[model samples]
Target: MLKIVVLVSGGGTNLQAVIDGVKDGTISNTEIAGVISNNKNAYALERAKENGIPELCVSPKDYDSRELFNEKFLEAVDSFEPDLIVLAGFLVVIPAAMIEKYRNRMINIHPSLIPSFCGKGYYGLKVHEAALSRGVKVVGATVHFVDEGTDTGPIILQKAVEVEAGDTPKILQRRVMEQAEWKILPRAIDLIANGKVTVRDNRTIIAE
Candidate 1:
């Protein structure tokens, strides 16, 4: 079984999707070893507890300094000995050392199609708001490797969702999450766990 550690900072809707996928056998041969969060009050931790998955909180506020927090966070993640790390709506910026160590072993779900309404300051509902302001007819989500730069990693899977007429940011956010993010994030993890995904020269090549 592939052991995975999921990182989250919010309600963990994406994390719940992965859990459901595993239970339904959509993501076969995988075990969610643990769930980590920066917020102790995050509902994701409660989800993990309810599911009997190991959970930890490594909040920056708990540490005396940023460096200390990073170290503790890394230690917390390593304790699970995860084969894969899933960033499912995790808000913390990953430490460079951890990214270098994990490399392609870590993946994240982004709220936008990427290369547009992505990168810095473009997370959560902000991404959808930007797409609406740009008047783009299409909005979507991306599953990508976590690189040193924000949302600049090799793409693994993308699903486009149409921006319907008179859609507000909140409405579009829900649509994109349901149509795109919820599906592809688990699919990407399944592909990776099954050895069907490969990264080459900063690009992803999925096998049949």
Candidate 2:
């Protein structure tokens, strides 16, 4: 069995996907170790409560310094000894120290195709807004290994979604979540949990 620690900040729609997958045995041989958030009021905590998973809230504002905040957050994460750390809408930027420590053991599912509507200043509805603004015919999701940079990690898996006409950011966001994000995320977790993922020279080779 694999132990997974999930981090979230907002509504936790992706977190719900993971939880449902585990409950239904779609993601077998895995147990959610815990869920942690930077915002105590995050609805994700409520989701965790419903699923009977432990929750940790370590808000960045509560700490006097960035280092202090990172140290405390890492401590909570380390306590679980998670086999995989999934960033499901966690808003905090991971420090280099934590990135190096976790390395390929951590993964994040971004809302749009990587190398496109990603990087700093691109998140939530903003990503979809950019896509619509640029008129990219297609948009999707990417699950990648977490490196120090923003969404610049080694690509693991991606699913594409067509940009429908008359699509607002909210509409596209919902579409991407349904058509891409929610699907590949848990599937990636399952592949890693089942010993089917391989990292080679900064790229992931999925075992078929």
RMSD of 2: 0.7
TM-scores for candidates 1 onward, in order:
0.99, 0.98
Candidate 1's residue-wise lDDT over 1-208, tens digit each? 8999999999999999999999999988899999999999999999999999999899999889999999989999999999999999999999998999899999999988888899989999889888999999998999999999999999999999999998999999999999998899989999999999999999999997
Query: What's model 2's lDDT at 206?
Result: 96
Tell me the TM-score of model 1: 0.99
lDDT of each: 0.94, 0.94
lDDT (10s digit) by residue, model 2, range 1-208? 9999999999999999999999988888899999999999999999999989999898989999999999999999999999999999988998788898998999999999898999999999899989999989999999999998899999989999999889999999999999999999989999999999988898899996
Give the CA lDDT, 0 to 100, for residue 62 in model 2. Answer: 98
Question: Candidate 2 — which residues are off by over 4 angstroms?
Answer: none
Model 1, C-alpha of 107: deviation from truth (Å) = 0.3
| C-alpha lDDT of residue 57 in model 2 | 95
Number of the top candidate by lDDT? 1
